[model samples]
Target: MDQVKTSIENGVLTVTVPKVEVKKPDVKPIQITGKPTLSTNFEEVTWAKLKSAICAIFLKQPDSCDLEKLYQAVSDLCIYKMAGNLYQRIEMECEAHISTALQSLVGQSPYLVVFLSLVERCWQDLCDQILMIQGISLYLDRTYVKQTANVRSLWDMGLQLFH
Candidate 1:
């Protein structure tokens, strides 16, 4: 491991932290837990608002949105349209993957296993990608899914879909 260095000048002290690198995950990643650590970026108000919105959206929180504020904050940052495009791209990719799996398999035992594996990959990829951006799983299903009579959590839904 590389060492972090600290230096002192006339009236100032400087500390340097080495950047850590991440390796590609084996096979794929899964949402094994409610939260996984990821690299974090700027915490300015705009980023904070976006992050909060992301958390709320993931959690399916009813009051987590204030569209007017979201518009203002995103427009102020000049990333409103870009963010929308990126979000759509992500959603489209997810939907494409699901549709591909559904169309290619014929629901045989082996094919079912393969499909389950894909679902596993999907769960992992979703967890990892979203965690990379939001840095939290926001586990909307934890409290409600367990207690609700008719609701299925994403994890549950993924399993049922493939099984």
Candidate 2:
């Protein structure tokens, strides 16, 4: 209970404390708030089902069975050989059907979730093949034009505009 005080000649006043007390540290227990939320409506669809559905669509065959069985049946078709307009038509149909199916199952089952991933993969693969073919065609076109340029030049006048 010591008290100290000082006053300045002009305008200052000061006070000091005699002692201070320190308390020991204490630990408090932590509590978790709530359970995690999970969606229980949808069943997990397998990769096999997705594969079959894609195959059926590409092959231009009917899909009568469940998605899993349809995927299995269609999976064996040679999708690579089917290109150009045919490929595009199949792709569009497949995308539409899959999207519709998935939307219809909202809160019903999670089986259609795999469709999104599978379609993306298939589309990417198809695009890659199409690009490769276009690249080859471009290379062949350039080579053919180059090879013909020399022969055509030999026959025409020095100032020939068209071959």
Model 1 lDDT tens row, 17-135: 99899898678665576654433442255556765665454444543547566545444433222343333333444445445555554453467677788767656655543443322
How many pairs collide in each candidate, listed in order?
A: 1, 6
Best by TM-score: 1
Candidate 2 residues lying further than 4 Å off, grouped into runs, are 1-110, 139-163
**Candidate 1 at residue 90, lDDT?**
32
Give the best candidate by lDDT: 1
lDDT of 2 by residue, 35-133 (tens): 654334211132234334445544446545464443332232212221232223333444554455445544653567676665555455444433332
* Per-candidate local distance difference test: 0.49, 0.39
